[model samples]
Target: MVEQTIIGIDVSRDWLDGFCLPEKQRFRFQNSPDGYARLLEILQGMPDDLKVGFEATGGQEWALWRILISMGINTVQLPPAQIKAFALSMGKRARTDQIDAELIARFMAFRPEAGRALPDEKLQRLRALTVRRAQMVDARKRLSAQISACRKQGVSAELEDMDSILKAFIETQISELEQRIEGVIAQATELSAKAELLRSILGIGPVSVAILLAEMPELGRMTATEAAAMPGLAPMAHDSGAMHGKRVISGGRRSLRHVLFQAGLAAACHNPVLKAVARRMKERGKPHKLVIVAIARRLITIANAVIKTGLPWRISSAA
Candidate 1:
């Protein structure tokens, strides 16, 4: 009887460390086309029905996973925390590419049904643009603060020149980021359409929409509760011996959470559907901010529904 194989690759900038289980064999390959070719050859030598898993380390999985998927090989991209937790559970506290590969192999062995992640190239590009845009926004804030400090400290000619140059650079980068995002929208009509639907919800705009389309592509694929929980919007349930703790939202895509929080504030004021919901919750003495969060979760649900069904936002009239 032939043994089923489990494989894991710890991808990095210059090289990748791969582990093959049942045999506990390891292979090192360069992070390039030739390296990928070697990987394919190695996998080809194994049984036809092999399962492979890897972690998402700074978009490292893209090149190799794309190659594997193109050649009809199955690959699962494990979340970073999930892989770490799995290692801790097995009493392996040390961290290394080799240990990560071993842990991933163990994870694959137990959870064979882990979902295959086939990321969209266009969405990836959008994600890059949005992240760059965020950096520019941060730079702008820092530069503005520095400029204010310079003025308060009696800036000299050199300080004035430096502050002006920094401010200009931040603005230029912000403008460039905006242009790149516009180009992404122009190229990806389907993505733009889904993004536009998200924008129709009063508070969401081009930037937020782009982030959602790129970071949370599974937004429409899962249920509302699932989507909320996926992004840590769904609160954790807490129970103890004669003690109860407040359920708190945690982890999963901090960038998305930030955008939703901003959008929720607007939705609470101007979005009729969300505004009404917030008003009703407020009447019941719920905290305004918490209600906004509830509205944000609902907005995510509506956005998911719109993308899933390819339908536009529709507001129903009250009787």
Candidate 2:
């Protein structure tokens, strides 16, 4: 039998800090095409059991990840925070690329599921388009705010020429991005069906569907509680002995949590089934904001169930 080998690489824009566990070997490579080629050259005949893991360094690790995965390598892009916590747990405080790389290896050796597989290329494109759209939308809003400020200060004309064209350009870009997102999803049969199913629910529109498809590809595969916790909608307990402390929501992906808030709020008001869930929570003296979160949880839970079962949402009294 072949021994299992796990390698961890701490990714930076300029260099890759690597450590191969069990073998206890350390190496460094440039963060470039040449570097990637050199790294692959070193591992040309590795066994099928070989696994490589790295922390998600924003967009920096994307190219290498795609390359390795394309070559049928087992790779995971881990959450940096978890790696940091793992280092602290081991009482390793001095931070360096080499140390981080070792910690990532140890972390993966300790918990194989600590990292996630990257989504498919079409999902990646959807995320890229949506992220750019969000940036453009935010820029347009800022420009509009500046125009309003100028009007208040009696100098509105100063931005008249620039703001109009910039805002128009931003809107046009946003529309084009939306079209691209739709096109990408339409080209993927699984995503197209999922999007149709998601949009069939009340209070979930194209933007919400796009977000779920892009960010939560594991939507139907996980449990309801897991799905809710993915977006930080799950209430975390704060109990010690008999203290029985208050429950609060925290952690998880912030963008997913944010997009759900609006959908949750809208569902709490507009979706009759979800609105009833909110009403019950409210009648029990739950704060309106708390009720909204609960309704959002319900909304996503139903979404998960429906997606997993390949069915559509229906009014249900059970919360």
Candidate 3:
């Protein structure tokens, strides 16, 4: 196992700041094709044992990530928060893109399994569609709320009409997006099969399936707790030296968690299996919110089991 070159990049719209460890070199390049080419040139001379790292700066890193992955260069997309935390732990109070790039490289060196490998091309497409759907859903919710307010306040007829038109448009857009999502799933055999398996569970609909398939790509790769934690659904205990504290959920894919929570609501009402789990928790005097979280976690567990086994869900009567 030869020592690898760990390179970190802080990507921006117009520029990229990079730091390469083991070689201790830094490069600043334009965020353009020319810059991408130069970065590749540098990698060409580096050891074959190379690991590139960068933060997931929204979509800014996507181009670079794809480029590196396509070039057969190892790349990892580190979470910004985790890297920030790592910086503070290192007692590096000051910050800059250059510093961040360096920290990312070091973090990768410290934690090799800190980020995900590039996902399948279909998974990437699913993610884009699902994310857009989430945005559309949120917009729809806001517009609905505004429409309700207009009705309550008896707003002018023209204003009400405009609101209605906008609402209808958003709804239509959402419907189209739903169809596209379905098509994307059908285009891939693995995705289509897994989606069919997921939908076999009561209350897991198309939207839920899209979000899970896109955001939870590691669905069949880990244990139930690992799956739950990826979406921040796991109950994290806070206890020390007999000084117990409340358990709270934190630090996972927020979008995944949001979509799962929505599904949990439906599953709690319609899925006999999950309803039983929720009922038991409620009977144990747990709050409604906690019960919902438990249901979400259980939903993830069942989904994980289904995908791992390549089987559709059988409506379980026993808890």
Against the true structure, whose lDDT is highest? 3
Report the lDDT tens digits of candidate 1 across residue range 190-255: 877777677666667777787887788887788878888765678787879888988777766678
- Candidate 1 overall Cα lDDT vs. reference? 0.80
Cα-based TM-score, every candidate? 0.84, 0.89, 0.91
Residue 34, model 2: Cα distance from true site in angstroms: 0.7
Better of 1 and 3 by TM-score: 3
Better of 1 and 2 by lDDT: 2
Runs in model 3 deviating more than 4 A are: 1-3, 91-95, 145-156, 317-319
Which of the two candidates, 2 or 3, achieves a greater TM-score against the reference? 3
lDDT score, candidate 3: 0.87
Write down the lDDT that model 2 would get: 0.85
lDDT of candidates 1 onward, in order: 0.80, 0.85, 0.87
Error of 3 at 309 (Å): 1.2
Model 2 ranges with Cα > 4 A deviation: 1-3, 45-47, 91-96, 144-156, 316-319
